[model samples]
Target: MTGSVPVHLEVDRGAVLDGDLVLPPEPRGVVAFAHGSGSSRHSPRNRAVARVLQEAGLGTLLFDLLTEDEERTDAVTAELRFDVPFLAGRLVAAVDRLGARPDTAGAPLGLFGASTGAAAALTAAAERPDAVRAVVSRGGRPDLAGQALGRVRPPVLLIVGGLDTEVLRLNEQAADALSAPCTLRVVPGAGHLFEEPGTLAEAATSARDFFLSTVPGPIGT
Candidate 1:
């Protein structure tokens, strides 16, 4: 079952972070996951999204932005949600780590993030415009990016729950700030996490399509 699709990897890329890496057989591209507030690589919701993306012929790396000790401290302070610069640095490192991997070298790359992770992803996309091809946000708080929003060049899709009014507004505001080719998709009845079942699937499908459409070639050497 070589081409049957590889499920996961125990890759140690000196990526500066640690977590799960899932790959398909000859993946069409890669999607790196940036977990939301208080979430990590083990997040069930992110895992679900990764599952769908994998089935769509993409590889996924779900890594924790903070170390265990930092996570414990962040849990009490709740300030990690505002640490977009730190998170963005790690994300870019992870993308570089993947780019250096033999198996992932030829694949186009994408970023899938939730909540604060979305802001971090936007920062990374802005910093590494040549590497990351596309971006996706789910109930994300890209507003945290402040003035960095306009720097991202990749096509991005922001998926918000129509019922999550506050988040919907935040996403709308963020969408307006971005200078990239982007869209805001409000999935009706699917509050924040798209916990309403098919809504998440729809988000996943939309994300897959967006990434596939934007990432069809190689980055400059």
Candidate 2:
């Protein structure tokens, strides 16, 4: 477990988002997390996956997609949580920030997105084809990416729970829409949240393997 540092990113003028950046010595690549609806950088599930990736010698950036005030409003309206374009914009900014940092610069980038965040991740990958190396989604709503799906150039892995029937179908559809290399893996008996024993571990393992094979180079060097 390499030590992680708290960092702030200026997504826009007067808008700063908080994140935790962890870089294992000689990390193979850096993966930025886009949490699901109503979730943030502090999400235990994302943090757990991030920890696994870090241990595998990958750098990780887990950041909040919304500010405190925005969350307050979203709690009531439930609108911002589904705003794909807005969320994707923030993710793009985060990727750019990582590129500019000495610690993460020049490293291949991957994205791990859950639920609605998956849609944003796809959109960001489509928008920044040269920067993102790969993408992974867990129980994600990638269908929300719409036409942008065809433009995404990086390989993508979509992990869904077999019990999450609707989302699995949606992921299948999204995979078909993508022109880039895409794969869909369904964890048997797992639900939408992968709360069943060992389900999350399976998903995390899949993510780690996908990133390892897709992202180029050894860690730190």
* Predictions in order: lDDT: 0.83, 0.94
What is the Cα-based lDDT of residue 148 in candidate 1?
81
Tens digits of lDDT, candidate 2, 1-221 = 46879989999657999999998778799999999999999999999899888888889999999999999999999999999999999999999999999888888899999999999999999999999999999999999999999999999999999999999999999999999999999999999999999999999999999999999685344
lDDT of 2: 0.94
TM-score of each: 0.89, 0.97
The alpha-carbon lDDT assigned to residue 105 of candidate 1 equals 82
- Residues 36-58 of candidate 1 have per-residue lDDT tens digits of 88888888888888888777777
The RMSD (Cα, Å) of candidate 1 is 3.5
Q: What is the lDDT of residue 63 in candidate 1?
A: 84
Name every residue pair that clashes in candidate 2.
26-219, 26-220, 27-219, 27-220
Flag regions of model 1 displaced more than 4 Å. Answer: 1-16, 217-221
